[model samples]
Target: MTKEKESILDVKLFKRLFQYIKPYKGVFFGLLILVVLLAIFSSATPYITKYAIDESIETKISTDFLFYVVLMFVVLILQTVFQLLFIYYAAWLGQNLVMDVRVKLFNHLLRFKMKYYDNSSVGVLITRAVTDMERIADIFGQGLFMIVRDLLAMVVVFGVMIYINWRLSLIVFLMLPLLLYATRIFQKYMKRAFEEVRNEVSNLNSFVQERITGMKILQLFTRETIEYKKFKTINERHKKGWLKTVWYNSIFFPLADLVSSISIGLVAWYGGLNVVLDGAVSQGDLIAFIMFIPMLFRPLRQIADKFNTLQMGMVAANRVFKVIDTTSQIDDTGTYVAEGFKGDIKFDKVYFSYVDDEEVLKGISFEVNAGDTVAIVGATGAGKSTIINLLNRFYEIKDGVISVDGIDIKDVTLSSLRTQIAVVLQDVFLFADTILNNITLNHPEITEAQVQQAAKDIGIHDFIMSLPNGYHYNVKERGVMLSSGQRQLISFLRAYVTNPSILVLDEATSSVDSYSEQLIQNATDKITKGRTSIVIAHRLATIKKADKIIVMDSGDIVEQGTHEELLKKKDGYYKNLYEVQFLQEEVI
Candidate 1:
């Protein structure tokens, strides 16, 4: 993972993020008005204090003192109201903005081809969707608007200080160069540190997700200590990344404080001398200048912090935009809609590769007539499963035509093409959901009775009923609550319930027990009755009844015929495979 160099203040990324804010311009503008009003009221406070001291207290004018008090009170109340409004509106805008980005990111992910998931990390995507989005929201809710308010306050305060006495203002401005230099160094170091932190966070997420997902593998192989050591290494890297940010903060913030203190001390020393020796500055002016020093420096310090928030938000936006800007989605310019496909499928000189030039399927051609049952058998990496992938257009073939009912699959809308075909893959994936919901996949049109009937038809209804909640049973994550056999049975019920025009079972029953296999074979008979079916199987005997058997080896079809017909070919590939693979299975 080579890191891309990012600008500390990425203007382009911020511009893209602001597009999400466009929809809520009214609220955004309201926030801006509130920020300006808050700044005006805040800066007015010191001036009111100065006037009360000089005009009312010094002159012993009771009425003038009371009037100034009332005015100050009013400004405080308005400032409080503005602060409240700012907090509320900022939250609302940030939440809505995050919602828009999250929805768009998810929809973009849905458009990605299966190859994207194959190459991308699930945990990293999860971080982008969940964690990175929250960071982006902070830019709106806590970072940008606060920065505006602080900056406005500083500008007004500085103007007031200069109007009171130019010499003191110049003294205060002299310390700013030191602060600015320190901030520049801090920003450069922190930007690199923060980017590193984000990368490490993503790395940690990916590692933990995979480790947890494969915990069973680790434990079974007794590699827990090894994995723990690996986790520690990643965790330490994450810690180091964060500590770099901390180290810069430790250096920069104290430097900012030292400069702020020096500016204030200079103002006090100079203003006190003028008041005492020359009588040029009033007591009120001295007091007001001291108050304005903090007011001026506060925003500068806060701006540095807000700049951090802004920088992080830009980083997050860059990552999220990268995902949204990806052009890897399947081309869906196809306007053809497949309605009630006739179940005929054909592969014409197909060629494909998961990676460039490393073909997985090479000029492979086959056909299955409507109502025919075809079985594919091959050793691992022999392109048996790749055929299933190509048929469904999960990956596009570099050179080929896959047609359903004589229409190129690419010409038809993906939704319609996929809706008519159901695949029960070898590794069944079930959500952490109720059994019924998993079966119907929350399809509104699939009624409870239909699900019950489908389960009964598949001969697994009794086994399901044996559970505490039966169809309502929670399968937990990835159906971990159920046995592998039970999960497979549920997958079968899910596919059967869809009642697809074409069915594909890719090594579906390869790892199940005999009882599960019997139920699967029985369900297979019911499900494949009138549909175009393609079965990729390692257990050759299970597919012996298939109308046609295509034997594959190293991305080429070496044999094709009915089971008995292929058996009669003496030293044929199918016969050799059957003896070497199936006979060994029988012996086991």
Candidate 2:
């Protein structure tokens, strides 16, 4: 009932689909040639049938009939050959077109920002990538070819009918409007039913993916029965939706058949009456008229079916275009970045909000001199992460200038600006790839020795060597094959390999065991030796060696000091955090 309708299937879909066939216009010309040949041969068939019925079988000694029969067979053979090639070319064009579309759509998806990924569902995205692409292929391979073949056949059938007997042809075509009205009615029902079917299928796919990914959580909570019920609900909905679609399609075919049968019956009865009562036409002419009746409506019927398929394909196009329609809010409009930035960062009265009314970062100002190590400490949701995110230009600032080396960040190309910075996030993400490859995600040309050196610096090289494949060892999705500490070690290596000018680590060791955390802290101290760094944590021990500690509360900086200076101030927030952390550890 609720539809997020826009022109997702606008001129763009047609333009893209057309561009795919631009190289194959020769194929289009060939298809047209085949259509015309098939039409001429199809029109000849009724005459061949009429001759057999009224002359050869009725007269019993016609030498010319044998020659006509042989000629008919030759036409039949030639048409079959051309039709086969027509189908082959159509299929080739369709397969390649869909493949191109999939490649383009996927690459476009990669260019989008984090906010785009955050708001979308994985199941819907996956469905667009695969199932919807298949639908467009169907349109090219079968739908377009079938409609063309049927239409040309209709044109030939009509010319023959009028030449044979216009009165009967006119009477037979009276039922055409009835057929159109019937399709309009059925299409309304089918579209809504099929839309529901697609949605249900998407739900089932998402349910399976989530259950597979979260099997551990489900088992931990002992919710196998509850999950089973949820799966059954989605599966049954999909089943019911499909059954409804089948029911509609099944009735649809029969309705067309009934209309066709009635029209054919009327033509037969009238043509027979003219012969019996008035004798106004020859036996051969009556036979030819009878043959033309089905030829006319069969194509018309096929045209309806292909139109139905077109509507279905358009529905899929609409879904795929939704992703294509989404604009990247964080747009890059500048030339390449300046070759060397001094890493002098400033947040000048910065403001940002995820939503219109709820400000995530209120008016705040800060400065970090080039090569300085600054530690940010705050309560949860104190906008510490927001400050680092803005500096990297990940989310565009709502107001004020965030500058790097005194140049507005918005003026630098996003890719160029990011190349000089490295971020070590609280949540470590590693691909299902070799350990060596994960470390050098961007700097792929780096040697194995370089990878090992970075890992050894982080105190993780020895552990990687302990694995069966050493540096070549494979990590599972999200590095699930490794322990929590191993994942953090790999993430740190990924950052270090970049040898970035600016380093920002956000709770980088939050989930690691104490032994690994200490190793990481020591490694980080070395990595940040000369680079401008913003280290966000409240662990107290991690920030003790920082050149300056920034204490923030509710989007405002409350204190700024060195570790010993902050500890000397008994009433400061930094001292309170340090006391709480030390006391908690002592209790443990």
Candidate 3:
């Protein structure tokens, strides 16, 4: 069996947890009051029988006895009515409590930096926040009130037994030590098993998500047999975890039954012998004694199961709190945006790395004037993307200053800095929604006519209209409904709709066909007429028309000049890239 870790919470969790409930204190007080009332009513059931047997059965017919019987009936009816009402409100309050927590967790995750998402997985983050939060919520919903009910009932049940006959009560209570010992052992085992079960579930979810997304890849490589074999390994691990749980659970039930059986047998032997030999206990008291034994021990049995539930919930709570506990190291404190951007982009002696002791960008420096088309041409993994990412502030600079419009990008608010910049990345992502919605997300209030005009100028409107729903077509996940060239065209339109002052196009037209390229080139030429445009592409055909060409290698700028000026340096990186794609080297 798997070993259970220590409880998820310490003293600190209780203090932090209470703060979230401060606004709903009144509802909690009402719940506590109802729990007390329910417990009191349930605890009185044994008492009513004791009185009926001891007094009413002896006298046979007295006005006092009749009046007591009627009173008992009235109490039962009142208990049932109020108990139903208690359930309704308890459930309502529990739902609202979980709703509040879910909303807070989601909003908090959004506030964290992109780096947080980069380092975390989809399954782990989702399971912790959603499924784990629900487990913690069960404590307040069903478990809390049940604990109070059983506790109150135990005390009153014991009092009734002692009053009916103290000697018999003493005999039945003797098994308390053995019961507690057995429970502690079983609880330890079950908690560990459940934690393993949770881990296995997480693995299953992660594998399932990956398999679905990469179904095409598996088929492409003809690796279905290998994939199936790998999946079996995960499945076996999950089954082993479950078997440990099942085995422990199977042992506990029989052990609980043995304890309960012994308790009952001991009560019967003592109660029966006393009546026959010494007249110490009456027949009526014996019946009530026997019935109350199960009532007493049943709650204890449930406490064993409930405590298991409580601890399992706590394990989940730790995972949920771990997410809430994460605080982004990077935050934007500046609240103002530059009134008018001069498009003066400057990077001064920037040094950065994603991993320690291994630099990605090493002391890179460059500057671009307002309304200039700066094209960066370099080999793969030459840190071209790193420069674009730094400008977007997706990753923090270890040392150096990246300024926009003479203000440090770090000093400006993230929202404002990103708002002024527009990026058309090589990997074009589109939500499964209408074409119009995808283009206008950055400017949702943009007129439909404006959207069509933008698409028509980019030469994709006619192709889009050829589809059944035209602009209203569902894009499918990641725009799978459209071809690569078609998706690239729409991605360009999205950036155009934003109307940003600084536009970053990373391999923007690499996927588009030649026919669509001239059209997109015409539209892009019009949009970048007065805007600062930064283009990063290996294709010399695309960057040849740029006002300035920057050639990069090993995260450092090797050469910078006008296209004609760079071409004059015959052996330079730009000149080499031009020779590779020489067929389309002409800039229209």
Candidate 4:
């Protein structure tokens, strides 16, 4: 939830964004040269007009006038060519820069610890990756380069105006201070407004995304009207944020135009007076002053608009850099690679907390020898799942060490450590892909034959073949095309095909029909044999065959033994839990 706080014109942020431009320096410099040419040619046209009027038309030289007109037409044609190149190259550079940034950002997100995602909104991240990136592209394509071209053109216009007649040029210069002041005020207010708009945009995206994803839940609870009202409130705020920008634009642009018009009128009135009375300012000079005033002042007005674009890009850049600069990723500095895990794991005095000063696992110590099936049975919130998450290195421990095969997990590479373990959760998630792809996860080393044999081994091969296309059948998003039991079966096949040394099933059989449970039970028996497995289940009946049972209560291990040994104890936690489940089963 933390955001980057920096100045509106933070030079450091600009330099960081500029690093992306380094890869395509050739295109960028070429674009710059094109912009320079555009500026020179654009400023030349008005001056050429001045010369044609004074030397050809005013002097009544028909042949000279024809030549100058043709020369002006050629200048316009060449300017058009440069403009085309500038626009094309600028857009190409912007698109390439954003593509690299989007890929890099996605890679960074992949390495982040689960803790970061637990606090961040998926909708906000989507906005950063999609919407905010578009704004960044504008910085290069339409913001900075265009502003530079306009400023350079304005400079050339001013230089020509002074060279023509200093007195008339002074008239135009007098209005600049006021225009600059207005522009400065406009930019200051606009920056604040832009930041508000971005924040609201993120909020709106988050609200809409969440509502759409959870539409079923909303309808189930009959809270559609309530959710609609909430969305309306967020949408209204987004509208107001945008309206502030509009309000500022409404006030600033007219003032700028009024100043532009006044400058032109002053130049005309003074230059006409001089031409009529003393002929100090010629008719040609007066006409060019009229042309030059807009050239000089127009960029000043356009600069304000372009600067707003630049400001929005910078705002987006700041948000993006915050994600890139985040240090919440798990440290992968360990050089050791766990080649063949023996599946022996030890958690020594481990303590962990998702939030500060609120420990979920308090000095919980346990061990699983190689090739042992250990069942961790506990009430909800007793940290049964937390242990599985820690074993996979999904969250870092605050205290103590977790070791696999006598090597501390933190000292082994994450990929090497995780590859050796496979987990089947109560909630199974499969990508929108074919059944074969879901099982193999597109792993290059896992072949179709291996997946098929694994499916047959797990006893789901017939169930899959009964589907529309067997292994090739596409399961839509989150495997919604399949039933809950079918999804769970797919997960089992996925875990089995991995051939992992350690298997963890966290409430994997808790949410299925009796028939599916039987299939899962059969699959479980095939997969867990001679492999180190940890089963966390609410149904005590399924875990009775485990080699060892560890009973937990309120983050502490309360009992540890095999099923028979624990049941033998009078008023034991395991005995009481077994009796409760036994009664529930009998009643059913």
Best by TM-score: 1
Tell me model 3's lDDT, rounded to 2 decimals.
Answer: 0.77
Of candidates 3 and 1, the better by TM-score: 1
What tens-digit string does per-residue lDDT give for candidate 1 at 1-588?
223464557666778888999999999999999998988887788899999999988778777898899999999988898899999999899989999999999999988999999999999999999999998898888888888999899888889889988888899999888887887778877778888899999999999999899888999999999999999999999999999888888888888888888988988999889888987888888888888888888788888888788767767877888999998888876889888889889999999999997988889898899999999998889998888888888888999899989999889999988899999988999999999999999999999899999888878889999998889999999998988888888888999999899999975665678998888788888898988999987565656879999999989998999999998998999888878878787788
**Candidate 2 global TM-score:** 0.88
Off by over 4 Å in 1: 1-6, 584-588
Rate residue 175 of model 4 by lDDT: 92
Candidate 4 per-residue C-alpha lDDT over 1-588 given as tens digits, one digit per residue, 9 for 90 to 100 = 223343447788888988999999999899889888988887788888888888888888877888888999999999988999898888889899988998999999999999999999999999999999999998988889999999999888888888999999888899999998998889888988999999999999999998898999999999999998999999999999999999999999999999999999998899989989999998889998888888888888898898899889989988998999999989888889988788888999999999999999999888999999999998888899999899989999999999999999998999988899999998899999999999999999999999989989989899999999999999999999998999989999999999999999975655678888888888888899889999996555556788999999988899999989998999999889888874577466
Q: For residues 491-580, what per-residue lDDT tens digits would candidate 2 score against the true structure?
A: 778888887888898865556788887767767777888889899964656676678888888777888888889889978887898777
Work out the TM-score per prediction. Answer: 0.97, 0.88, 0.91, 0.96
For model 1, name the residue pairs that clash. Answer: none
Better by TM-score, candidate 4 or 1:
1
What are the lDDT scores of the predictions, listed in order? 0.88, 0.78, 0.77, 0.89
Off by over 4 Å in 3: 1-9, 62-73, 85-88, 442-466, 508-519, 582-588
Query: RMSD to native for every prediction?
Result: 1.9, 3.4, 3.1, 2.1
> Where does candidate 4 have its weakest 10-residue lDDT segment?
1-10
lDDT of 2 at 438: 87
